[model samples]
Target chain A: MEKKNTQQEIEEEIKSKGKDNIIKKIFSWILKNVKFLLIPASRLEELSIRQIEYEKKISKRKFIRRMKSTLTIFGMLLIFFIVTIAVFAPWFSPYTFDVLVGIAPGNYDPPSPAHLLGQGRLGRDILGRIIYGARASLTIALPSILFSLIFGVIFGVIAGFYGGWADSIIMRIMDILLAFPGLILAMVFIAMWGQHMEYIMLAYGIIGVPYYSRLIRSSVVQSRDLPYVQAAKVTGAGNWRIMFKHILPNCIQPVIISFTFDIGGIILSLAGLAFLGFSDPQLIEWGNDIADARLHLYEAPWGAFWPGFMILLAVLGFMLLGDGLRDALDPRLRNIYGAKKKKRKKGKKEENDSYEKK
Target chain B: MTLIEEKTEDSDRDPEVILSVRNLRTYYPVLGGLFRRKIAEVKAVDGVTFNLYNKETLGLVGESGCGKTTIGNTILNLVSAKSGEIYYKGVRIDNNFTNDLRKKIQMVFQDPDASLNPRWKIVNIIGEPLRILERMKKTREIRKRVLELLETVSMKMEHLDRYPHEFSGGQKQRIIIARALACNPEIIILDEPTSALDVSVQAQILNLLKDLQRKFNLSLLFITHDLSVVQHVADRIAVMYLGKFVETGTIEEVFYNPTHPYTRALLSARPTFDPTTKTSRVILEGDVPSPINPPSGCPFHPRCPKYLEQGKSMACSEDVPKKIHLGGEHYIWCNQTK
Candidate 1:
C-alpha cells in the first residue's frame, strides 16, 4: 500500500502539469535545433527538423555542389521552356508544318531577308520546320524517357528483392533484351510495326530497362539485409510496404545518378531512330531536319549545320548537367568533402594537444 | 483516477492470461545444388510454448540462433508459425487476428537503422496506424496524439517532420516508441531495443522503456540474450535453448533457484563486476549443434551435465521432458525439475 502511494504521487505530479507546458516544451526544442542548424554543426544529427534541410545542408560535394546550382537552373529552364513551348505549340509557333511560307529547292535562296535558315531540299524554310518540330520532338523524348525509367526501376527492385529463381529468371530476361543492341532492337521493333511515337518510346524505354532495373535491383538486394528492413517487418509492416518504403529510399542513389545520364542517351536514341528513316514527316524533329539535309550537304552546309548545332547543344548540355548531378548528389565521391574532414580533424587534434599540455 | 485511467487499469490489473502458446515450431528450409534440391530444415524455432498475462513483462533469453527473435517474430505473425496455436487475448493468432490485432499489439525493433521508413517523416510513421486502424477522420487529432507520443518518449514536437536517419540510435528508438504508442497498444514486443546502442545509452533507453510501460499500463515481451539486462527489468524470465524454453519463473525465482542445467549454465556465463572472483566458466563442450540436424530427444540432452543419472534411465533421446508448474507460477521443462 505504501509503495503504491509513492507511485501514484509521482504519477499525479506529472499528470497535473498542463498541456500548455508540454506544447511549450516541444516548441523550445524546435527553436534550439533550428539555432544549431544556423551555426552549421556535425555531419549527422541526433534528430532533424526535415529531410530536405538534412539532405540539402548535409549533402555537399565541392565541384558537384558548386556546379549543381547553376546546372539545375539551366536544366530546369531548358526543360521548363521546352514543356511550355510544347504545351502552347500552336500559339508559340510563327507557322505550322502545313503553312507554305517561303522558298523553292531549286531557287537556292541564300541568308536572304525573307528566309532565315535559307531553304531545304523540299522547298520548305529551315527555321519554320525547326520551330514547328519542337512539339513532336518533345513527344518522343519526354514520354520515352519517363516510361523507360519507371519500368527499369520497378524491374530492378523486384529482381533484386526476390533472389533465387525469380532473380535468375528476371536477370536472364534482361540479358536477352541486352543481347540485341538498342539501335538493332529498335530497328527490328520499328520495322515490324510502322514508325510512330509509341513504338519509338517503347523501343527507347525497353533499352533503359536493364540499366535501371539492374542498378536499382543491386541496391535493393544489398539493402534487403539491413537492420531497418528487418525492423519494419518485425513492426508488422507488410512485405510490399517494407519494399517500397524502407528499402526504396536507401536505394535511390543509383536511380538519381542514372536518371540524368540516361535522359541524354534517350534523346540520342530517338535522333538515331529518326536518322534511319523511322520518323514521321509531321514530327518536326531535328533528326528529320538532318535527314532531309543529307542530299544538300554540298550546296548549303548551314542546312546541316543549324540542326546539328542544336542537337550538339541539347545532348552536351544534359550530359554536363548529368555529370554535375552525379558528383553533387554523392558526398563521398567529392574531393572537397575530404579536405573539409581533414581540416576538422586537424582542429580537433590541436585542441586536444593544448589541453594535454596544460 | 479518472474514468478512462481507472477503467483501463481496472481491466488490465486482472490476472487474465491473454496468450497461451503451445508447441510452436518454425523451421526454415535450406536448398542446395544447381537444381536447388531440398537439403534440410534449419530448426530455427523448435517446439516452444509460454503463457502471457495482460499486463506483464516477459523477458526471453537465449544465444543468437536459439530462436528468441524467431519466437517474437512468429508471435507477431511476421514469420509463419509452422505448427502451434498462439492464442492472443483468448483468440487464436490467425490471418484475421494478425491483421486486426496490430491495433492492440505492436513491436519495437532492435536496429533503429532499419525499423523506420527513411522516406517517411516521423509524423507519417507514427500516424500510420491511426490512419489504417479504421475509418477515422481526425487528422489533426491524430497529429496531436503523435506529438503527445513523441513527448511521452521525451522527444520534441519538431521531430515529427524529420526522417529516421536524422537521429542517433537512442533517438531513433524513441521515435520507434512514439510510433508503437500511437495505436494505444496493450502489448509491445521489444526485440532487443537496447542491444544496438552503446552501454551508456542502453541504461537511458531501458529506463525510458520501463517508464513508458508504467505510465501506459503496457505489457511487454522483451527479447534479449543478455541475462543481466533481463534481470533488471523483466517480471518473468524465460530461458530458451535450441529453440525451446527450458526454465521460466519470476526473476527472483529463476535467479535464486534455477532448475534446468542450461539455465544454471547461462547464469554462470554472465560477466560479474568483481574481477577477482572466478565464477566457474560454463565452457559447454562443442559449438551449438546444427539446427538442421538437432540431436534426437531433448534438444538440450547433448549439452545437459546431469542427463546421465538425475534424468530418466531410459534413453535421453527418447523422452523430451514436458513443462511442470511448481507453486507460485514457476515452471520448468527439464526432467531434472522433478
Candidate 2:
C-alpha cells in the first residue's frame, strides 16, 4: 500500500511539470507576437493625443464663436429652411405640383386660403411647385459644381506642377475654353446634347471647369518653388509626391473659397437656362415656373413673385456662407474672429527662455 | 615659429577626401527680348575647385551674391553644373547622383520659415526622409524613429503635432536640422543656417550643430557671411570672391596670415571687441561686379586694394592668376600673393 502511494505522488509531479512546460511555450509565443497588436494600440493612443492637442490649440469653440455673426447665422437659417421644405415636399405641400384644380378664370386666382401662394395659369398649386423646385435646383447645382471641382483640380495640378511642355498644353486648352463666353458655350452644349435636365447640368459643369482650373493653376505656380519643395526634392521624393502631397495642401485654401462662391453662380446659370426654355417644359423648376407665370403677371403677380423670391434666397445663402468662410480661412483675418492671441505670446516667451538657457 | 611649422606639417599629412569638386562652372541663362531667348549667362559658380576632408567643417565665407549659396546648390545638383566633375567617395555624382548618394547627402536651407512646409505637422516633415529613403512604411516605426531624431535635436514628443507656423524661428531651424539628420547623411550642406536667428539663438544653434557633428562624424560645408561665426566653428576656411575661391587654408593659416588681397579685406571687415587697440579697417571700394558680365582676369581686380597698391599692374586685368601654394594646404589665386 505504501509503494502504491509513492508511485501516485511521482506521477502527479510529472503531470504538473508537463503543464508548466505548456504554459511557458504559450507565454513565449505571446511575448513574440504581442508587439504587433500593441503597436497599433499605441498608434491609436497617439492619434487621440494629437486630436486633443489640436482641439486645445485650434479650438472649434472659437470657430463657433466666429460663426455667431448675424450674416452667417441668417445664411445658415435660410439654407436650413430651404432644405427642410425640399425634403418634406410630399407631406407639407398642400397639393400635387402638376394636378389641375380649376378651369378658366378660377385657375389664375390670386393668394387665397385654399391656394396659399395662389394657383398657376395651368391650375397647379404654386406653393407646392416652388417647394418641389428646391429639390431640382439643388440636384443640378451640387453635382455639377462637384464635377467641375474634381476635374479642374486635376488639370490645374498637372499643369502647374509639371510646367514646361505639359504646362503649355494644358494651359492652352484652358485658355481656349475661357475664350468663349460661359453662357454662350453652355447654350451651344445644350443645343447639341438635347434639352434634358442631365444634359443641362453636364453643360454647366463643363463651363465651370476652366475658371476653377485657372485659379488653382496660378496659385500652384506661385507655391511650387517654395523652399519646402526643394527640401522634399532633396529627401528623394518623386515629382508626384511633391506636387500632390506638399504643393496641393498649401494652395487648397483659395480653391475652397472659390468653390463655395461658384455654387451660387452655377445655380443662377441653371435658372437662366431653364428660363430661356433650354430645359424640358414638363420639369417643375423655379425658372420654368417663373417663365410660365410671366404672361399672367399682370393678372396674378404672386405666381411670378414667389418663384423669383425663392431663387434669390438660395443664391444669397451661398454667397453669405462664402464670405464667412473667406474671413475664417484667411490667417491674417482669423485673429479678428475671437481666436486666442495668448497662445502666440506663450510660444514667444518659451522661445526666449530657451535662448537664455542656451 | 616651431608651433606654426608643426601645424603646417599636420595639415600636410593626407586625410581622407570624401568630396572633390574639379573646375565646376554653373551658369544661369538670362532670358530677354520678345521671343525670350537666352541673352546672356550669369556665371554663378565659375571655375571653383576644392576638396572636402572627412569629419571636418569647411567654412565658405563670402559677401551676399558672391555665389557661396550657388556653390552649395551646385554640389547637391539642385542646379546643373555647366562644366565640371564632382566625385563623392571616388564615384562621379554630378547630374548622375543615385538615390543612395542622395540619401547620403542632405541640405539645411537658410530660411527656416521657408524650408518647412507650413501645412505639414512636425512629425511628417521629419519623417519624410525616413519614409522616402529608409522606406519605413509602418507608422509606428516611423513615429518611433522621428521621436528619437527629435530628442537628438532637443525637441519633445509634444511638438510632433504642431504646424510650422506655431513654432518660433529657432524651433523651426531645429526641426529642419532634425529632418536633415533623419537619413543619417555623411555630409550636410548648411546654407546660412544661423543667419536668420537672433544672436543668442544663433549661438545655441551653432553649438548644437557642433555637438551633432562630433556625434555623427559628419562633414559639414558651412556657408555663411558671418565672419565671427565661421571663426568659431570652421576647421578650415575658404574665402570666395565673385564666384571664385580667392583663398583657401587651415583656419589658423588664413586667420593669422592671410595671403590673398581679398582675404585681407574681408578679415579686416570683422568687428573687433577690444577698445584699446586701434586697427585700420580695409573698406573695399565699389560694389560686387555683375555676374552676367564679370570683369576679365581676376573678378576682384577692379576693387582689389593690392591691385591699386601695385600701381594697377597689367597682369591683374589681362591674365587670370593660377593657384599659388603657400605650403601645407594654404593656397591663393592671386598674382600678387607670392
Off by over 4 Å in 1: A1-68, A84-129, A154-193, A224-246, A291-305, A316-358, B1-15, B134-139, B307-314, B322-327, B336-338
TM-score of the second chain, cand. 2: 0.95
Can you write out model 2's per-residue Cα lDDT over A1-358, one digit (the tens) per residue?
1455687888997898777877798988888668756676553454443344455555522456556567877888888888888888777887764453234346768778988888887677788888888888888888888888888888999898888789899989988877776667668877787766677677777777888788889889999889999999999898889988989877777777777777767766766776676766566677677777888888988888998899889877876776676555433344543547554656655554565455
Reference contacts preserved by each model: 0.43, 0.71
Distance (Å) between predicted and true CA of B150, model 2? 1.4
Query: TM-score per model for chain B alone?
Result: 0.89, 0.95
What TM-score results for chain B when candidate 1 is compared with the true chain B? 0.89
lDDT of 2: 0.81
Measured with C-alpha atoms, the lDDT of residue A338 in candidate 2 is: 50
* Residue B162 in model 2: lDDT: 64
lDDT string for model 1 (A3-107, tens) is 556778877867777444777888888886786767675424544433333354344413445455666558656666656666776675555657633435544
**Model 1 interface CAPRI class:** incorrect
On DockQ, the leading prediction is 2
How well docked is model 2, in DockQ terms?
0.43
Please state the error at residue A301 of candidate 2 in Å.
Answer: 4.6
Candidate number of the best lDDT: 2
